[model samples]
Target chain A: MSARDAVLGAVKAALGRSRPADPADPAAVAAEALALLADPDAVRPALPGTDAAVAFAARVVSPKVGATLDRVEALADLPGAVRRYLDGQGLPHLLALQPDPALQGLDWAGFELRDAALPDEAAAFGLARWGIAETGSLVFHSGPDTAVLGHFLPLHHIAAVRASTILPHLEDYAAVCGAAPRNANLITGASGTTDIEGSYVRGAHGPRFLHVLLVAD
Target chain B: MGTVFKRDVARALSDATLKTAIDRTTVTAERKRAAALTDYPQFAAARERGTRIKDHVVAHLDHYLLEFERNATASGATVHWAADSEEACRIVLGICRGAGARRVTRSKSMLGEEIGLPHALEAAGIERVETDLAEHIVQLAGETPSHIIWPALHKTREQVSALFKASHRDPHKTEDVEAMVESARRELRDRFLSAEVGISGANFLVADSGAVCTVTNEGNAELTTTPPRVHIVTAGIEKLVPSLAHAFVLLRLLVRSATGADLTQYTTFHCGPKRPGDLDGPQEFHIVLVDNGRSRMLADAGLREMLRCIRCGACMNHCVVYRQIGGHAYGATYPGPMGAVLTPALQGAEKARDLPHACTLNGRCQEVCPVGIPLPALLRGWRDRSWKDGLVPQSVRSGLWLWRFAAERPRLYHLGTAAAVRAMRLFRRGGWIGRMPLAGAWTRYRDFPAPAGRTFMEQLRDRERGR
Candidate 1:
């Protein structure tokens, strides 16, 4: 028997089942999975009001999460907001722009931009599909348009989140993303570590800063 | 007591630096966890919800494991099953060899440490770099991880600086944390870009979504798995949750309990390798389901509750005994209250007989446990089993027998207790015992106060006569 058979057999034996699963009937396992997921909402934690985008912003910029936010009035103003953030932080105009239509399609003038983030790039921009109020998380889906490195390669990761996409709780993330993408990256704040001497050091490997461009629809 | 654990504890106690590190980190972590929980009152309900999900998953392990296999396979990922650590290592090594990988990068995987994956890769002539800062520090120093969450929790900043100096051969600043972190990033940035394979431990395996969810504070897990050609996730069979929704419940509680943070900086749900037109991601994705001793744990209903552990390290943080000796004294892949029960359960009762005795039976670990595993009760159960298996040392067994003999005879019990109190008083100076025989372990850390030189019966009789 294969290792799979032995493992499943061991589990079956522990559960007091008579035999290993039939090789041909693979759907039986999928059926079992669907049954368990049937009540996915059976258990949920209480959350803030559904219209708590302001609360979400509060949590995001809290000292513990340590992320800064910028709210824009329209999609067209995103580039200007990014530029404003860069100028405020004393960063340069050169930044890596994620190769997505929603971002790349924007008319980015006056700023030197690369299609994808370079290893040594100082800043990069991407779009979050949803914002979680419970944890102040940005949900990004990975696909042909979404370059996974755009989130990790740069020192400063600038994300554009639609104000209308904010959800009250973390559970809303699965409902929105649906687990269909290749990967769902839910980042809560700037990267940090206390591994050296139990002292917090920001920007360990990922970006030191996560500045959000909360665009109002 | 297990001889190995006893000697390890004795050796660990002398390292004053280890004690200080453990004291500071555990206190800080516990305070942060408390503060984080207070900030989110729903955390109380969330932990209960997490327990419900995990309990269901553990009861129906076979169904979810098979379901996970089917969905992952459909998503263009391969799922391998390993009944033991050796099998797990062989499968990972086979993947590396198939990719013709010369260098590999791995994130912090307690399962990897349990299965000795890094050593297996090294013995195969592969250069494996641990991407997590704590992991890198220990790997560079040629040492095993001292803590599950913080591997180099025992090492001081100077020690880490020394280790980096020896390995990187750089004059990185010793006092500045950022300079040291920057040095590591500079050295590892190229390795992450060039490595052929990346290995990570799964925080949760979603059967419905066919995703392996990983939680990281530093985002090293994403960098480790994303940039490589082959991404291998080795997780225990018990890591499975039914769907992403259930995983969210546990994720909220886990981050708060572990780091005292609202959420980890990065929590990525990876469903497959790379999609058909993805610009960047590992081309090959594999999930190895390991069942080293979990099947046995499942077979025993009483022991099965432990499979619900999220590896939060909260139990260890609150454990008084863990605060003193730290993780190394347990001398196992896991340590503290969780390790005391888990080491013997996974390995055997005879192999780690001393571990169960190491805990003080305080209910703090269980109180703080997110999954509510009844850790003290489990340790006590192990102690009872140790007695029956004759795993308890002969000296302890004889001592218990003598105490039981006197207890059955009430007259002798009173006489024996009265004599012992008088003898204890002889060693007292200023109402405190400077030294006590056969209780050296108790007094070694603190002074023992002298008891009144009388039994409870004598004291009661005198009080009644005076009245």
Candidate 2:
């Protein structure tokens, strides 16, 4: 086939046709695009603030959310808040997986703890640093100090997220990386499988419930 | 030659049952993700971090993967290296056989799909059950995944209900998602407990601690990894990060990009086999690292960035064409922008010649990509490669030559444009073109709005004289 025929064939395959007019007026196309943007269903709308985000979360995550997974603005002492929450839960026998230096001097006396140790089969909790976030997800990276099983092997998981480390768009994340890395994952949520007849099951290979400890110092 | 991808996609789209199923499922995920990412400034930064970490990792992949192997082995976890899909499959199967595993539960892993591992396992008298909600549907129906995030999006509730009735021990006919979920949960719970071995894919493998990270919304990955005596993690070679701190950088970008989640309900990390002090964990842990064609991707600077992808499927979700055509059309394990570049590059030019050119060259995929891969540039590169390799039809080369000739001469270009305008005007009816000779396929479903008289340049010239 001639090059023209090849291009046409490819175009035909793409459009399922022979020849497509490559639009006439560029400005008119832009105008049409702008008009399409007006439709609520056409383009994604701009993000709302804390209240709006909470409302959206309520709609999607749970309509009857009580308190444990509540939304709060960036806190000054996030690690402390996490410690306090764990203390209140009456379960502070934690096996911290990948705690950062930012959490160096937090005091937890009355509770038996394994700070950044290998996840024991009986570890109450496996704490690790998250690599990504979206819709309240805490990502975990596997390595020597932290076992891939650490995040899942433990009954409870607490992820320490620095508030400053968030992005609005996936494309923005791509821009930051610029190229493929040796290893990385963009986790939106915890380990889940819908393998059984499309049923959504949580904590299949990892944790059953995920709690994000947003630490902003 | 059969345009395998085109044929499959056409079959899928034409199948009303599949189209409805896909549309319903993808629409829901798209909306939920939009809501989750909205109003979160941190999401933007996380995505940037994810991109940067992957870029750095890919640039120094040999260093990182070797580092990971050393660290993971030190942690008492066996790490097997595979240079290609075949090697990867062999290594995994060998481990399964060594452990004397008969049945295995798997969380959703696209890499597994790419290598066709399940079929290979089944041939060896091993039953591999897909434990992901969407994956189960496709596996039951004996169909390929229609979308990246929501594999069974192409199936309707009614169809799923029927499938559940046949498959579930006690199935209900209700369309209620909760009821359906409960039914599936009960069935899978048994499989999770009974299975001797579990297989999973890693989102990232941290080198510092010898950990494998699997992130999901359903929590099936945890069950697949634990409970079972032996847990096997199969991941691409590129899924290695330097440290846990580095893993954090990528997490911020992955979840929001994949499903717009701040954090999935279960983001578990697994280090190795169950320790002596552990209660209920796998006794044997093995990680199978599959290189496939990633090494080739890493060697080339222009295409290496594609490896940084977190497999979030954001590009596919946001793509106008993909949203319309769906995943099966790509005819590869991957089905969107990333697939278009990666599949052809990994598999070869002959297998996926149509994929690269089957796009509108829109920048939406690039716009939403979490790892900053220049998809259009990469797609164009594939097209160039296909042409050079003689994979493209003779007609295409001739067309390009003619177009190039016309482009170099102002007179021919203007004349051609004028002719096009005239031809388009002839097809006008009711302010739109219902059907045209060559572009019949597009007009079959959607009408093309007719252009105003004269081209933009012509109008501009006229305006210069105050028309």
Candidate 3:
């Protein structure tokens, strides 16, 4: 018998399930698992009673993750928000941006923007596919427009999260992530490590500063 | 793996450096975990949900495992099954050899340690690099991990500096934490960029979408899973959850219980190998699900609850014995209260008979356990089994038998206790017993308390009679 058969058979014999179901029958197994997934009785935490954008902004600036948050009234105001955030942090006005159409039409008056790769010690910007308000994490799906490298490999990371896309809990966000992107990163804040003498130090191997721009309609 | 608990604990206690390191780190971790839970108002509900989800999954494990395999295969990844550690190691080595991988980079994986993967790979001439900062320090020191979450919690800054100085080319590096972290970042960056294969342990294996979720604060797991051509995920069969929603429920409690963080810095999900338009990711993805004595645990109802562990390491942090003796004393891949029950269950009661007796019956581990495992009860069950199997020491067995004989009858019990108290009074120095014959082990450290003028029953009877 195969290793899979031996392992599954052992589990069945241990469970003492009088008659074991065939594991090779994908349709029956999938149907059972899909029923659980389709309507999961998940325990969702009580979200903040404030607006979605307000909750997202508050959590993003919380001490746990330590990411700065900026709310803009419209997509047209994104460039100003990014410029002001960079100037406030005393960062240079150069960035590497993912090739998303939502970010393309922005007027780059005083900034030097590049594509495909993150520049050395520079900031990078990407659009978040969704925002989880409970943890203030920005969910980014890897695709042609959203470069996975742009999420990491930079000293500073700035993500644009539309207020409309902010979900109250992780269960709500799970609904939006059902399509199964090739790679999805739910980055809570800047990279940190407490490995050395149990001290919290930012920028272990990823971006040191994470700035979120909350774009409101 | 044998019963060397006494010798191992003696060595750990003498190491003043390890004691100080564990003292400082566990205190901070315990405080942070408490504070993080306070910040989240719904932590209790989340923990309950996590326990229920795990219990449900373990009940129907075969279906979920098959579901995960089918979905992962559909997403262009290969899934392998291993009934034991040897098969798991063989499959991992086979994958590396097939990929022509000479140098492999890995994140911190407790499962990897459980199966002794590093030794197997090294024996086969594959260079394995541990990318986690704590793991890297332990690897360089040629020591096993002393703590589960914080592997290098047993090392001092001076020790870490010495290890790094010896391993790396930085001869003049100072003994500063930031400088040490920067040096490791610089050194491991090259390994991540050039490694042929990357191996990581999954925090959760989602059956719905065939994703392997990894939570890390240092972002090393992300780098390890990325950049390499072949990414291999080695996880135990108990890691399966039915859906992403169920996974989120456990993830919410895991970070708080482990590090007191609202969420880790990175919770990346690797759904499968690189998709059609992906720019940079692993071209091939493989997941190795290893049983390694888990099915045996699942068979016995008394020990089945041990499989509910999420590898959070909270039980160890709150354990009184563990805080004093540290993880090295356990002499196993796992340690502390969870290890006390799980070590024997996984590696039979006969081989690890002393592990169950290592505890003080303190229920602090059960109190702080996120999954609500009755650890003390399980340890007591193991002790009972060992006694039945005659695996206990002869002295212990005889002492218990003598106590049982005297206690079964009221007259004999009263007379036995009265005579023992009178004899103890003879040897009392001032108010404490400074030394005793049969209890040299107990009296060697400190004085045993002397009995009062009368036993409790005599005092009670005198008070009731108005004497």
Candidate 4:
């Protein structure tokens, strides 16, 4: 009678299922989905044996991702690393920081810090929820403190991740993120495009440079 | 569609620029894919897992689609079902109208092209801007995408620069790739910020979490889904996978096969709109599950494997014929070996009668297919069906019949072959035949090599007899 019914009917007839599943019983469907979600380890590939932090550092610095990695011995050392990276790249003094507790209480004297990402911000920094070693991806969950636009809208993106938060594989990252956040971005490297004659050009629509500061305690 | 295939192929072959463009791009893509796979040792295992997951999902598509609907609805998003392109367009337009959307920013979606969404929206007085760089070029040029992943692979830098200069207000544009990309970035940024609705195609629809995952290197998909108030993901029913883990398996294979990257720059999972504490994201999330002709594809057991396509474009990249003729010659939304079988299966065997015959039966497509779809067998099956349906041209049918008659008996076959070789010797000049009867098409391109005086059978028999 409805589009849904017609689609389901056609699918059922094609699949050779004589009768369709009961549409009224959504609980059963949800239960089945929950079962699938509960076991996220199935069909996972065997990852490399490198420790999460080491793998994360190695993968990010690889030519494929082309992301610069900075290691900090403690959270207190983050500002120094960020300052050194900014000075090394000869970037501007101003940077937009995500409104997160981890990024707060940092001694940023010379830099003009803003809470929101401006359209033309030279660099924007955010705290990653987790680091995926397999793909050198930073897992950022969308929340009040972590703005989604700051990750892409800026010319340069700087992310800080705790060494302990790094995981070996995407499956592990998925389990950590739970069912779903509003947005879960696994940003691996600087934004790029091969759209023009298949030439690899970085910073097509997103940040040109991605520098990750891996804070270890 | 029938006449356009040959004409398009002819034009593509003659265009040296197009040939160079395709040859360079496809060679680079193939090399990258090979190198990426070598770096990832688990590619074979992951591909197997991906195949198993897709097979399971397609087998139980009805169940998974329902599960996805329930979960997505529970996550504060609306799910709409469209049995055909008309319904899909109607639902999308209705949603846009309901939300009072005028300017829509769309990420590159093959499904959007399949359903003619842009034309539909334009007809309803909505301005649709394509955000992908290649897609933007094709959009400005008023052309359908030639390749799925790299839509403007057929366009040279000069052509793209010309298109930008003609379309954009920038008078100082150069033919440099980065400058053109920057120009597009600057122009589309305003559209992304100001669009009322964002439309995208999902790489995978996670059934458990009701998340629509889109993979992109340009981050357009992320921007397309982020800023707009209404984010609509239009995906075919076959885009569904059981869970996030399954999605990762396919994701690994997809990037490696498509662009030879270890992983795309951005693989974002949008669960629903924005969550309770989210600062910025779309407030409304909707998914339109489009069937179009997939139900018919599923109805036939032999054709059901077409639904397993991840649209990685590997088949076309590796296809010799596709490399020679390019994608426009296929005269369909999809092209190449996959398109040859899929186009006929989706849009009747009769309509695309010439498509299945365009293949050289190289089996390269199937060899490189990540899903291991026996594409050559499928194309051959389509050819058989076309012949049975009387779609083959009369000349071809009569030629095949003549060959069949001669081949039925070995004695007659040898006799006919000997006679043909004798006749070829008479017409031979410079070790080649300038013209042949009923094969003007073959002779028009290059001289056919004259057959040896004796057939292979006769030579083999004499050699065995120690002559």
Candidate of highest DockQ: 4
Error of 4 at B305 (Å): 1.0
Error of 2 at B417 (Å): 2.9
Docking class of 3: medium
Q: Is candidate 3 or candidate 4 better by TM-score?
A: 4
**Per-model TM-score on C-alpha atoms:** 0.96, 0.72, 0.94, 0.95
User: Candidate 2's C-alpha lDDT?
Assistant: 0.64
Model 1 docking tier (incorrect/acceptable/medium/high): medium
Ranking by TM-score: 1, 4, 3, 2
- In model 1, which regions exceed 4 Å deviation? A19-50, B169-171, B465-467
- Across A51-113, the per-residue lDDT of candidate 1 in tens digits comes to 668868887898867899989988888899999999998998998887778877777998998
Top lDDT hit: 4
What lDDT does candidate 3 reach at residue B216?
Answer: 89
Please state the error at residue B438 of candidate 1 in Å. 3.1
Taken over the whole model, the C-alpha lDDT of each candidate is 0.85, 0.64, 0.84, 0.86
lDDT of 1 by residue, B1-467 (tens): 36677778888877799888887677888898999887776665667767877887886788788778989999989999998999999999999999999999999999999988989999999999999989998888888887788888888887877777777745476558788888888778888899999999999999887889999888899999999999999999999998787788788788888889877999998888898889889999999999999899988876888999999999998998888888888888999888888889878888888898888887999999988888888888898998998877788889999999999999999999999999999899999986899879868767899998788989998999995
Residue-wise lDDT of candidate 4 within B92-209, one digit each (tens)? 9998998899999999999998888989999999999999989999999999899999989998888888898888865325668888888888778778899999999999999888
Deviation from native of the Cα of residue B39 in model 2, angstroms: 3.4
Q: Which ten residues in a row have the lowest lDDT in candidate 1 chain B?
A: B166-175
- Look at candidate 4 and tell me the lDDT of residue A212: 93
